[model samples]
Target: MLRFLFDTIFMVKVAYNDAPQPWQLGFQDGGSPSFEGIVELHDQIMFYLVIILLGVGWMLGSTIRKFSVHHNQIVHKYHNHGTLIELIWTITPALVLIAIAFPSFKLLYLLDEVIDPVITVKAIGNQWFWTYEYSDYVNDTGETIEFDSYMIPETELEPGQLRLLEVDNRIILPVDTHIRFIVTARDVIHSFAVPSLGLKLDALPGRLNQTSVIINREGVFYGMCSELCGILHGFMPIVIESVSLESYLLWLSSQNSPPYSPLQKPHQFPKLGNPWGGIGTPSRGKRFYSTSSSSIDFATSSNEEPLPPLHPWFVTGLSDGESSFIISINQRGNGWTVRCSYELWLHTSDLSLLHRLQSFFQVGSVNLRKSRPMASFTVAAIDDLFSVIVPHFTNYPLQTQKRSDFLLWAKVVELVHSGSHRTESGLLEIVSLASAINRGVSDKLQTAFPNFTPYKRSLIEPCLSGLSPNWICGFTDGEGCFDIKITARGSGSYHQVECRFRLTQHIRDKVLLELFISFFGCGKVYIRSNNKAGDYTINNIPDATNILVPFFDKNPLHSSKLLDYLDFKQVVELVKSKQHLNPEGLSLIRTLKASMNNGRRAKD
Candidate 1:
């Protein structure tokens, strides 16, 4: 019996995964918060297993011993089920099932709830290797941070490194912060499993699957590809090195194998072709690229909004659309300097608006590059940023998706404000915060900061208050839509080109669609696709031509959508002119519509 018990204990030890510990029992202690719950549920189930075994074992033994044929003088009548016994047998098992169910459901729920992650790390599993990225963290030059983590060869492993688990580059993470892994595959299917962290997600080709983890303790946790991923299946091992936020930041800063010289700049991206199709770069490198303060064109157009100054809220709203807050590593003399700057870009036509903001903010400079058609309002001066720009937003905050970034930017500013950038440690902290802002850290920052850590992401909650014109512009910059569709009759003849303005949302966010009705003073919310989607739509030609056209034309879209809007506006004008009446007119409208959203196919 003692030997049996000892063997059972050994079995339990074999099951623990934490690190395949000596004399281990059951599962390895979970490396993350949710994993602990998983371990607890496993233990709870085992406890029930032991109880069922012992209770049944004792009952059988006792019945056999007490009711022996040798001791029985008379046998009981043919067996009939006792009501009490039946009740105990049926309800007792049900109770036991209930006991097992509650925590099991809770553990499953805990695993499914993906909390807002501060840093989003993308992992792509390949046939024989893995590539990890920190792309969201971009630089002032429109650069991003990305690198591949290949498994270390056995012969190259360090003395203390686990032979097969060691990697040329380790996955570094922060302790006590949420991390979301966007896992995908380049070719065959693979699973990125980290047993210690209780994370096992299949990496499917062209499909992005997400799983979040928060490590409670800092240590090196090893994982492997559980799926059969060809000849190198064993070679691809995962080594996650978790550390405190500060240590992780310091480590990240050390990654620039060959540090970036400030002279190297990323190329400029093209303008948005179709806003409805895809968002190109955020309205001209506001996140990463930097424009010189001297190049800003302060020349306001004759028709520009004159100063009593644009209201701070209006400025905040427009900035959410037209502006970018950039954290940049710049060249000053022979040395590199890290600074935070704000820019508001406009076509030469909106120079007066830029000038208006410049006067209102009273900090930034305005300029136009000699040959460029665009004018800029820029505030690169550190003192003015903290004194004027920061305080204004603090009073009347930005109410768009960009608000989260603004908060993170403020953190960077505070760090810069306190002269933290001058110190080695402070610079590292700034690098960590910098990687998490905007669309996410880019590959450039990763190369610059070896130990770059991504802090908790800013929570991007929409404005809860009433909407204003400028606020609507900023919100639309991120989510609004304008569309034109041309359909054929059942008989295959061309019908009138239908023009509509729309904003779509998941059924859960119907209120935002309702809010649009109040903002536009026109349009109605229509439930599309079996109540799965809600669209705020205006299909009326006059309303779109008269109301929507003038508003956007005056205010103007600052994104790739501007291209689509211009195309859409042309189609609306042609349709209003009865251009669809004749073949030549119809052909012109068709030609213009072809270049519009989702291209020719979607329009038809």
Candidate 2:
């Protein structure tokens, strides 16, 4: 019976040997003193424990000795006399504790210190898995590649691989290299910990925490997720292999392809219920609402016919006392053309207005028409459906030029598109106008009237009437006005000008100024010039007017009103006459011409 039992035990050992060893548990050469620092600290703690034990043992021995010597002979007890002894004992222990605490504090601070590392790796924790990225190390072409690490299952693991501990891919590192690690999570909280290296950090979703490590020895080490994140958390383990730089590089390249085959069957992940309210249903349908209060009844009776199609819309409550709207465009006809419109109710005309529309079926165009607070648009569809939206005032306009009104409007468009279901392809268009301005100005006029400045006021006040005379040339004194000023410079052949005037607010004021250089197109006005004579130069000069207009009918400058004021036309003639002169001379003439023309146009 004993022989049979021995044979059974031997068989069991052989069966266990057939199982794979954990990758992390395998022997490796990292370097000298691989765990010396931790070992030293542990030894120091053990030494202190031993010293305490010895001290306690000695005290007990002394008490026993004293008791044996005195036995029954002691007759008087004086508690007050022992005060000095009590003080000595108390102070000595306190001193020992302080001595221990000083080093402990130092060690803690050292652990917290995140030194400037030679390399940084980001570790993202997910349900029962971990993903790592070498964010700082990019290839010569600036491309970065990252991979996920998953544990190998017990049944398919190779020989010598430990069950529940072997991973498909090992974290490869160079021995003696300091590495900074950033930890984060994708869904729930997780922790990254390696006991041998004395490193542990929490990975919180949406937040990043950091720790550092330097492996002194080249070896494969094992670690497991320190935090209980899910049912499979215990199955997830970390395997790190530290090697020389050359070996590490080789291993890294080898990891381009995973060693083990992926699981044949799809992982049966637990269905996640509604985390916000703890609802157990995994595939709940989307809840729809018809009103902002979220109280509108959407339930349908069994006998009632299907309700009418719900027109989709989004309302964002803004910090300002107004809201905006977004409308989606749907493709209805056989061709790409599709039209959609919406009527907004307003209590007062004081509210601002904005619109955003998009299409999805096919690439198409958008057209917008506005009459006061009402707006209509037609979107040519490429795909199946399109969408549009309007939003309310969230912030004051142009309170600070630093605020990006256009970017904010873009976000509103995105919100509208994402809120709707569209099948067609189309373009998105956004138009915004303040309620106070009945007519919108052109891009050029807008550029000129930045911040609704004095120039804007000069033009807007007089041009509201369509029949305003040429104010720059003083052709109509109070009837019309124009204001022009140099706003910016560039390194090209032209300069930028801010132009504003009152034209009919309802009429399209945009005009293309074609430069008639002897009936030829000169390049648009640019601020920078190649003139050798260092004369007046402009950058980004438009294809329109070549002359500058500084003032309008209300305020005529004497230089502009004078016949011999060296206007742009006269300067051009003069430069032509001085063809033999240097480019600088020509440039000077051009500058004088631009200034005179600007002033003259304003007065005209």
Candidate 3:
């Protein structure tokens, strides 16, 4: 009996109370104080309306009944001269309007006034979906949590989920907390409106509209795009899961977790329930969605289930920046055993990504360094190097100067596979080729083979006339930089601020760096004479604001660099608004600049 009563109570507590009901005449239950106030103002106006309606109806009826020709048998002469009735009718409405206007204005201003909120969520409307970002929180790697919410198709909807309203990801917020939503649209105009909370705001492109709300209770509320943006606009839905403060924090933590590392003991993660509702059970092989349509697949298993593979283009782009192809000569007895290996290193936080790469190529092992916060994926077996690593890169092709090094390394791999390392001449040739790759042949090998000539490396001729957006995005995540520079102009008190988008590579990749000029239709390539390094930089304000900003806004970086990009973009906006001329705005820009890149790492 107790269990039955508890179940009944739970059912009643959640029974579609937060959603629309069939043939309902009134609004859904208000879950916010603002909505409650709106309701009160509505009722106040309705009360005055009822009184005016009754009074007018009674007066009309009395006038018709008393002045009828059949009853009075006479027509009133000089009735138009009566000023008392006219005065009463006009004055009564004026007094009623005055009473209504006060509360109406009060509620209007209350809705417009914005309080300082503890949490700020950025909601960006796209064609048919919503993108949300929590700007206040940063994970261990200095990355903010962001995700896209898409409506679940009717075919995929579960038992209790609402059609056209159920979304794959719901925006979670803490109940009773003052939260600010900064809304804007990416492509076209859309509206972010939740009827239950009385939240309705237009998400205009290129303009940010902000509103504050304090959820009064915990439950799931649904909303849709109220604007007629496009045909699919009806498909976009908004889901808000207001939960307790503790549950919200748990969800936040789960979103920004670093990829698992082998060096550390497995950390226990709190399970929140369904993947769409909470951080899904990792053991159940749930897939996490990125801001894009492509999902970042993650699964846990004890029976050796195959992990998801990464895109080949992404692999090539990352390898062009982070992977090293090396030929190392180690002493075995009195002779040398030259071995070839391909390696990529990442911060320990990205160990899971490396694991995915391993699963992608069907080779390599992930290992951790004992001395640093780093992990590596290495392919050292001769067969694996020749069959998997070599073939993958050959098919995808590296675009940077790394391609030159890869070519050299591939030669050494072939030599080792052919057992040429067993002969003196072949070993000398292998070492010479290795000498041209990363960290060149070790000092001992160079000292031993002092007379061997270094391999002649041919310049890599890129096949394509342009850069791929995905490849560029991935490569930027590794070698690209979004920087802000502030320096004094002349000897005056004024300062000059500049936003820089740069890609630097070794001189061998100067041709590749030059390609960026045509690729972006801006930016100049400068080669450092002393260091043989090439820098592709865009310093023109117009170019940075127009070309570079929009490009990156469309194809975003995926690493911690994203934080820097966001800051850079913010600085660009400040500069655009001429805010940097003021002391406060300059100081804010300086703070942002200082908190980026190395400053961000220092804070970490």
Candidate 4:
């Protein structure tokens, strides 16, 4: 009997270590420190529950057997008046609860505390797949290692591959290292959960939610989306392979090599000199191929893997940063023809990202300049702008000064959609709204429409609450600045360093700048003396180091501005360490400052 019991326990343990097994009743064995703590807490709570259950059962049995009518016809006078028993009963349960609460709160706080992480992995949940980006490492190609992970379908599954739990790409991490996972959704809210690691975080649309883990052992762990996302939610599985640091570094090198398309799903992750060899075949989705630093060629081959669809909120986030809404008044034979269009201008380096945006909206045409590193994606069809652009921004609204522009631009798009742009009054209204968005009407159009009174733009109440981290990152990529100014104090040789993190917008949206202060809990809004612009600036070194640095370190910038930010952050560190007072550090600071923002572009 003892042998049978031991065999049963061993079989169960062997059956479920990293993935769910059929008829499994217990958790997969704890694979991280947090998971072990969770299991210990669970066992401790169960022990108390069992003790309480047995105590109650015994007391009830004793009462019934001792005071039954069949056993004794007379009732005892002391039965209803035992103060010691009452106190004991009341205090015993309270003691048990206090015991449970102490451990529960300790574990809760432990789980909530995020240690300084060595590596950061961003996981974006899509409708039926996952996209993972290693945010800390940028390869020689000037791109972070990013790829989509889709569950290998059952039809394509090999003999040993777990159905619905295997993904073409597994998130590779170094075991025994503090790793942070920043989870967000491109479309809907999905949960990134791994039971063995005791890691679960909501992948929210627009917003970023993060959790940290230290995988205790090296192995492949499997999890699935715990939240209902869409029809294919059940198929969205997560697979993570924790490897040694050396092996993980090799894998990173393989991923970052030249001509390796981030869009292409690898058939086999190079045997990373590890025990777990490789995942299965390439995923069926691929689209863009990088021809040069400035060009992205769409792969039209029959077997080319397709790319993942863009999330609506991601599109809105990019729009808030890099897009413009325009109202064009063209000179026709007699009267003017008003055209509404949504446009995005990006460097040729971001041509691939622009192409994805065009693919997402399914209406825009990407036009490139031959002589310059510039490309524009324009959606000019009135119907497409109304049907696609309008409803999208309406649903996933922009969270910046651009939100106001979108509101005004949307009104013009609506007028055009309703055929009101053909009328004289409608044309004037479009001209008025056009003047309110971006640079408003061009000089030519303003001269053409002499009676165009600038529209009294409705006040857009700045979104001050629940601002998505992604939206802030996007808007900052467009209008934010990280500046370091070093000046000599008086006539002395002493140099004082001023590190400021700023976001500027038109004076009309000063209230929007206030949102930055509220969101960051640091920084002040200062309107320019000319009253034409407003700046949200964090001038204090402590605020820049403590608040701004950590915030951006977690919710990172994806553009070239990220280089400026990195330089700015380094200068802030030098100032904090009082190293900027020295000639060597000061010279370093000067070099970094000179190579930031426009300086970086000029240097390139």
Best by TM-score: 3
lDDT of each: 0.69, 0.41, 0.77, 0.77
Query: What RMSD does each model have against the real structure?
Result: 26.4, 26.4, 27.4, 25.4
**Model 1 C-alpha lDDT per residue in residues 308-342, reported as the tens digit of each score:** 54555567767765678889764332334677888
State which candidate, 1 or 2, has the greater TM-score. 1
Which lDDT tens digits does candidate 2 get at residues 465-542?
A: 212112123211111223334433455444433332221111211111111121222323222243221111222223
Rank order (by TM-score, best first): 3, 4, 1, 2
Cα distance off (Å), candidate 2, residue 283:
50
Candidates 2 and 4: which is better by lDDT?
4
Pick the winner on TM-score between candidates 2 and 4.
4
Residue 498 CA displacement from its true place in model 4, Å:
1.9
Error of 2 at 301 (Å): 78
Per-residue accuracy of model 3 over 1-604 as CA lDDT, tens digit each: 7756987878744444677677989989888888889999999999999998898899899999998997898788866676897898789889999999999999989888666565788999988899999876642224467788999999998998898999988999977666789999999999999988889999999999999887877989999999999999899999999997556654654563322332222233333332113222332111111111112211232224554456678788878888888777887435787767888987654555677777788766665554576667777778889988889888888997688899999988999999998999999888888888767767788789888888777778664453687688777877888888899876857889999988888887887888888888889998887868989999868898899889989976655577788999999999988899999999999999999877876665
Sequence-dependent TM-score of model 4: 0.46
- lDDT, candidate 4, 1-604, per-residue tens: 6756988878644333899989999889777888989999999999999998998999999989988999889978666778898999899989999999999999989887767666789999998899999866642224467888989999999999999999999999877777789999999899999999998999999999988788878899999999999899999899999997556655764662222233233334332222122222221111121222232432222224555665566566667767888877777535787777788887654565566677788775665543465666777777788898899888888766677788888999899889988898989888988898877788888887889888666666767653677777767766778998888986858999999888888787777788888889988999999999999999888998999899899977655677788999999999999999899999999999998877866654
Q: Candidate 2 at residue 270, lDDT?
A: 27
Worst 10 residues of 2 by lDDT: 285-294
